[model samples]
Target: MQINQQIVLVTGGARGLGAAITTTLVHAGAKVVVNYFKSHALAEQLQQQFPDQIFIYQTDVTDKIEVEQMFNAAKQHFGQAITSIINNALVDFKFNGEDRPKLTNLQWSEIQTQLDGAVHACLNTLQAGLPDMQAQHFGRIVNIGTNLVQNPVVPYHDYTAAKAALLAFTRTTAHELGEYGITVNMLSGGLLQTTDASHATPQVVFDLIASSTPLKKVVSPAEFADTVLFFLSPWSRVVTGQNLIVDGGLVKG
Candidate 1:
């Protein structure tokens, strides 16, 4: 699981949390494929920054054809031997001035989109990447999850349910891929500061959560990126199918 000289693809990697993860992996000496749905400018900026080690692919994870094309393009650019994948793409949310979902008025189409964006994307990546990973006898798959699935303090019904399904998929994949030296795990976190996704949270809500945490602060994208790097590193080879919470002590086991 050494990241050096490895090929890793990160979905939704143009900006926000995904950007941090992509940068972290690139710094670790892994060749990175930065996937984005619409952030063309950011994707180009990242490619410019890591000219030799990074490449960009515009992909909508919810679209199976687009996802397939993305992987194909990455293989064509970096060869057909990718070693790792980080399933971190998600559809944009319309938070409606609150942290919780309006269950009674939530749109079914919106919910379906979130589920497809999260769960289906992971499934598609596995379907596309497994052949090569199994052949190479080494692979690392990390699915990003949310601490809300544990606490449900802010019931983002669609988001939490989708992530929960993703966690389940991670475990099942780990079990099936273990014999081949492929590891699959999840990293769940509470509100992460400085990400577009978290910008919707009211200042008061963030303050309250920070005060409640034993650490008294929200996690930075870099901190979360560090955990992801560890899971991708050889150190986590023995670990698989477990959801590791990184919520600054907000959700106790």
Candidate 2:
């Protein structure tokens, strides 16, 4: 896919990592749909920042009906089938490892919530978009994953488990969709520097991560978002069902 020639939809695009991805896509000349569950004002602000490049829609990616409606509305608004989709919408979470539930004390509901937010959300969006992608016989899907699933240095039980589930689904879907010319992949990153979610992370933890990373610095959301662009662009057309870890060599996989 040519960045400037694709119609893109990014879920959870109102703030943080999603926001960075949306901005990068728009600037690269792709027409982007910004999907948000809340933060309408922030969405509008993004609209004003980059005029005529994006459409803001408030929808929950976890809901089948809403996901279908978003894709439909995107086609109507952009006058083209969405050629690329970024499943970046995350369920609300703060990256405070200290407060995260340990295995012995973890509640099923907590795990379920993460699953709903990550895995279920991806399923809803992928299913809703598949028909259009099949009709076009061309599409790109990128799911945001985490390095924790591989490195898991912090031991965020529920969160890492949910991301692992998403990775499994990503690969399975890619295999099924490969014949249709749609590629599915995951871009996993380590602790981002200062996103709303990571702001809650302790400075000591950040220092530890930076010191241990090959780059000796925490990955920024913008940097992670740029890696997402690679999957969406023509350079990666032959690649699918792979997890590209963009954590400065933190996790070898």
Candidate 3:
């Protein structure tokens, strides 16, 4: 799991699961670029805490130009070659409780927003980061997915659909890029206990999930971060295009 001297980029790295991933990468001896859309204050605070190891940049990953600029800025700071990326940023996870939209009433705008965060963000990062990895002949990409796509007991139609699409894209890209020594994989988890996104979930819903799981508990962001870091490390070189679910054995794939 040695990542010494590697430069890693994490989208939506300002807070929540993304923040956990960023912290893990930095602590693992990799130079980390934390990409945030609006959490400038938190990003700056994190950078201040790890001045020499962590860098922060603001970019809307849904936009091509912004994504390119983020990579360029990161390269300028961390050097031209980035070795890994963690796609963890997402739009609103507001469809949790009373606000959840039924499939019949789901608006195109709502669907598009989720798609922008899940699919488009990954596309932007892959398009921008692949060339550098290809040129360097080594790269690791880990896209964050959700357990809802498998269980769907709660039924977040838009979010689940978008993540399913992300998994498909990750597999296709992994196959296409394997010849170049680049590995693309996905990490999917369920009901992370203490993130801003998970806060929207109802207490009863979360409790049910926890009790039903073999582990009888929800996962922490740091726990999920561990899996992402594993993928980035040298140990996972032979693993690619697979969706690894870390949901307390709630959904066995």
Candidate 4:
């Protein structure tokens, strides 16, 4: 799928990384549908920014029915099939290492919730969009992940474990979906300098990360979002089942 012509669906596209991806893709000439569970104001704000190219659908992406409904509505609104998706929706989480529960105190329910948000949500969106992608012979699926899965600098155990599982899904789906010209991949980023989720992070932490990285700065949501366009572009037609970490070379794959 060429990005400029891609009919894209972005989960949790109302704010943070999702919002950046949605807007960047829109500016590149792709019509974007944002699947938002909340933040109606944020969703509406995007509408004003790209009134003709942005569409908002309220959906819990873990629900198969709701995901399918969003897909159908997007096609109806855009007058074409959605050719790509960026699974960036997240359950409530923060990067506070100090307050995070230790392994001994962590509950199974905590782990389960992260799984639902990271793994199952990807499953729902993929199932809903795969048929259309197969019919069209092109698809680009990018799951937003975290650097913690690889480096674990902060030990967000539940979050990292869930993303690791999501990577497994990315690879397996890429293997199976290859025959249909569909590519599945992941983009893992470190503590983004600024996001609604990362707003709680202290400046000292950001400075420490910046000084540690080769680029001398923490990754920004917009910077990571730009990489998404690459996966959707025809340039990556031959690539799939890969994990690309975009943390200013803090961790190499």
User: Among these predicted structures, which one has the highest lDDT?
Assistant: 4
Off by over 4 Å in 1: 94-100
Query: Which is the better candidate, 2 or 3, if ranked by TM-score?
Result: 2
Superposed model 4: Cα runs more than 4 Å off? none
Model 2 lDDT, residue 138, Cα: 91
In model 4, the worst 10-residue window by lDDT is 1-10
**Model 1 misses residue 229 by how many Å?**
0.9
Across residues 1-253, which tens digit of lDDT does each residue of candidate 3 receive?
A: 2587788889989899999988888888888999998899999998999999898999989999999988888888976566788889989876375778987899888878999999999999988988888888899999999877888887788888899999999999999999988999999998887788888778887789889989898889999898887788778989999999999999988
- lDDT by residue for model 4 (1-253), tens: 5677888999999999899999889988999998898889999999988999999999998788998999999999989988998999998888777888799899888888899999999999999999989999999999999878889888778889999999999999999999999999999999997998898888999999999999999989999899998888988899999999999999988
**Model 1 lDDT on a 0 to 1 scale:** 0.86
Whole-model lDDT for model 3 versus the true structure? Answer: 0.88
Q: Compared with the true structure, what per-residue lDDT tens digits does model 2 show for residues 173-232? A: 999999999999999988998888899998998899899889999999999998988998
CA lDDT, every model vs. true structure: 0.86, 0.90, 0.88, 0.91
Supply candidate 4's per-residue lDDT for 231: 89
Ranked candidates (TM-score, high to low): 4, 2, 3, 1
| Per-model TM values vs. the true structure | 0.95, 0.98, 0.97, 0.98
Model 1 worst lDDT window (10 residues): 92-101
Clashing residue pairs for model 2: none
Flag the better candidate by lDDT, 3 or 4. 4
Q: By summed lDDT, which 10 consecutive residues of candidate 2 come out lowest?
A: 89-98
User: What's model 3's lDDT at 109?
Assistant: 88
TM-score for candidate 4, residues paired by index: 0.98
Off by over 4 Å in 3: none
